[model samples]
Every structure is written in structure tokens, then in C-alpha cells.
Target: MKERKIALSQEDFAKINKAVQQAAAKGSKDSLILYRDLALVTSITNRTVITAIDGNNMAEHVFTNIDSAVIVK
Candidate 1:
């Protein structure tokens, strides 16, 4: 098996957190957060990321079980 790793700065994490908060405010239980080249599947109610997909893998990729989506600039 191969393992993939990602490094995020505090500021980047803060941004993602803010997005999650916004989703929660909108009554989203699950969300797809688009940040830069990463697509994160998050659980709004749980306040945690369920999965992440990079831009390279996003082509023709299908995301399931998400109730909302947020694009972060």
C-alpha cells in the first residue's frame, strides 16, 4: 500500500476551519470543501474531515454522501 501525506500551515487550517463553520451555520451535515487544489469531504456536524482528494485525482471523480459544498479562495 502507498501512503499519501499532506502538510498544512496554521493559516491554511484556520481557513478550512472557517469554511467548516460557515457550512455548519448553513445547516450542512456533510460538506465538500474546495480549497486550492484539494477537495475535502468534511462532516459539518462532527467538525472533522472525512476524506481529501487532490486536483490530480479529481478528474472525473465522484463525491458521495455530502450535503453541501463550499469553495474557499
Candidate 2:
């Protein structure tokens, strides 16, 4: 697991929770969530974040095994 250095506000957690719920409703097992400049991989069933990546390291990153993607603006 990678170190989590992102500073997430309460509102950010709310948004992410909402997005995860929506994905779960759609039967998504794993999801990729994009919020601001951060990207996170989450397990909908477990309600856990698998990994988080910042914008600085996102350019060459490739996501796999995700059944859905949610972009939170």
C-alpha cells in the first residue's frame, strides 16, 4: 500500500461516500474516483480505498480492474 498524504476535507469525504454509494448501486466491485487533482481506487463492497494518487504522479499511471469510474467536480 502507498502512503496516504492527501489532505481530505469533510466535504470531500461526503462527496466520495456519495459517489461510492452510487457505484455500489450500479454493482461496481472496484471503482476509480477522480476528485480535483487526486485519483483514488476504492472497493465499493468493502467501502475502503485501495490506493490514492496525486496529480504529480498521474500522467503515466494506468488503472486496472476497475469496473466503474466516478469524476467528482
Candidate 3:
């Protein structure tokens, strides 16, 4: 597979970090689902976003292998 890059602002980065921390605290493991303006599928163990999808295309996709979800607006 081709390597994917997801650009995020400093504020978005901070928010994702915070959300990951909170999810970990709540006993989450493995993958983490984060929703900012777009949807992000992250690996908690790897500490990286595996993929991202814009909100407009979110409805047509199905997310799997996620242990928890965080919404940041």
C-alpha cells in the first residue's frame, strides 16, 4: 500500500493527543477512531493515524478494528 499523509494543524494534533490519552485512561486499546472536521483511523499501539477521510465521504465507508472513538470539534 502507498504511504498516506494526513496534514493536521498544531491545535488538531494537540486535540488528538488529548483524546488518545483520555481513551487510554478509559481502558481503550488497539485502534482509536478520532473525528475532527474529518474522520481519522489511528493505531493506539503504533501512535499513528492509519488513514483519514473527509466528512463528505464518511457516510459511504465502514470503520473497523477500532477500540474507541473520540470527537473533537
Please list the C-alpha lDDT of all candidates, in the order they appear.
0.89, 0.92, 0.71
On residues 1-73, what C-alpha lDDT tens digit does candidate 3 reach at each position?
A: 1333456778877888887777777777655455565777777766777777776667878888888888766
Off by over 4 Å in 3: 1-6
Stretches off by above 4 angstroms in model 1 are none
Top candidate (lDDT) = 2
Candidates 1 and 2, the one with greater lDDT: 2
Tens-digit lDDT track of model 1 for 1-73: 0234656789989999999999999999999999999899999998888888788788999999999999999
Clashing pairs in 3: none
* lDDT (Cα) of model 3: 0.71
- Which residue pairs overlap in candidate 2's backbone? none
Better of 2 and 3 by lDDT: 2
Candidate 3 or 1, higher TM-score: 1
| Ten residues in sequence with the least summed lDDT for candidate 3 | 1-10
**TM-score list, all predictions:** 0.92, 0.93, 0.75
Local error of candidate 2 at residue 73 (angstroms):
1.2
